[model samples]
Target: MKNIIILCFVCLVTISDTNSSSDGKEKCEGIYVRDKFHKKVVIGMGLNRPYQLAYDHHNHKIFFSYNIGKDDEDSFQIGFLEKGHIKHKVLKEVENGFAIAINNNDNVVYFGGSDGIYKQHLKSNDSVIEKILSHQNIWDMFFKHHLYFIAYPSQKLYKYEHRQNKTIPEHQKIIHEKIFQFAIDGDEDKFFTNETGLYRIKNSTDHRIFYEGPKVYRAIEIDNKGVPHFSGQNGIFVVNKKNDTLEKIAHVKNIFGLAFDNDNNIVYSDPHEIVKLLPEDC
Candidate 1:
């Protein structure tokens, strides 16, 4: 009887494993309420490791950077999903790379890889790789009013003016001197970074601690209203520039990427899913 009981337990374990794997294989479809707590919209396949996500309002397409395998060795591709169809084009074939941004025109995509910064033009069907200032790894990039902002793990901020075509040092005033991620305000006057703490830079002013918390991954200015919203390990927090109030919007395990659609829909990526959260009334 003891052996029979043991055999039954073994069988149960096997069945459970099978079910878990099956669930992982099943593509999550439609919108789901995360743990039944908040509404979520899922897009694309179950991504094993998604590096970044960007939305192209011009084409109504969502782009995803996916890395495959243990050291990210197997595959690295930039894919787009639109109108229920998914298509991908290889940007890199190596492991451990980063995608910075997709140009508003959807004609150029910039990414940082183990080698260096790469620019790919969709129209010309060509790619150019250039070495940026640091090899420590670039985390993100944002373009505002012809100025390009590059964030690096070294906590340094660099800006490149399109007209001048040169990298300028913009780190002398940053508080922590170590920046993890950042976002530029639409107006080009203010920008926020996630370093040892939340820091904001404007008009050459040095780092000013705005909020203190775990490392932040991404930030976005909502509605061109100057209210800065950021995503970190603790969840999403919003800072009201006018009132100087910081408040939590929602909570998730980890946010890897963030983008706001034209309709004010907040789209972000958590571990295995891409979620879109609309305001309660909407």
Candidate 2:
């Protein structure tokens, strides 16, 4: 049972603390993330059950999903982080939160849930959320060239283009089975992962199996040069666009969320703590 609990945590669903302190803050474990020097530091705490993360390097902000239910509470939440402060709002309408994407044109973050996709103006005084699209369960989303490519677990995919100068979205449809996470390359190429392999979508007509193996992998995190990295059963692995080969970065497992800054510094969270795989000390 103990191992099962840890596996469930690694598989993405998480449990939360149910108490608040006299300071009017939620009583949970302190937030700890390893810095670029591979040094661990306690940053902040009181998050319910922090899950998938999206980093906005252009704005120096982070967005994540968490459980908001605690001690008679009954909601899930999405959190925004900026300048060491976090503000979370309850997502009462979203049933299951899965993915997040940041749009460079507007600098707004879009969140995917079981029911629909939603967005809000970041750091706005009036926090009104706008629904982008409705689906049964949105698994992941990616933004490229003023458009969003959304993944559905029901073996379908859709493209939403921001029209009228990013105000209205025109939706288009496509079907690709088992596709999960995707990232756009500098050449407008798509590098996506699936249930059993890594694939590539290029030239608007080619869907080719780039790599397939016995091991199950998580979503793809691409760097500035279009290199993809992931953390899964074999720890963190990298797929370089130049060679398209799998390279293992670390042996640690149970990585929940992973992000890469421009310098190729890696920050990821396990079930217990966040860690950074800094570039080799040169």
TM-score for predicted model 1 compared with the true structure = 0.66
What C-alpha lDDT do the candidate models reach, one value each?
A: 0.56, 0.59
State the displacement of the C-alpha of residue 157, model 2, in Å, after optimal TM-score superposition: 1.7
User: In lDDT terms, which candidate is top?
Assistant: 2
Task: Provide the lDDT at 198 for model 2.
Answer: 67
The C-alpha RMSD in Å for every predicted model, in order, reads 9.4, 13.0
Tell me the RMSD of model 2 versus the true structure: 13.0
lDDT of 1: 0.56
Instruction: Kindly list the per-residue Cα lDDT of model 1 for residues 1-282, writing each as its tens digit.
Output: 999999999999876666443345422323322222335657655765555666666555666666665663644555556645533445443224565565664556566555445555544434464444445455555555432444444646565533377554364344445655556665444555644466556555554546545445554533335345677664777665666556676676667667666575677777566667753321
Name model 2 segments beyond 4 Å from true: 1-37, 40-49, 67-76, 85-95, 123-127, 146-153, 162-175, 203-207, 212-214, 262-264, 276-282
Candidate 2 has a TM-score of: 0.67
- Evaluated at residue 91, the lDDT of candidate 1 is 45
Candidate 2 CA-lDDT value = 0.59
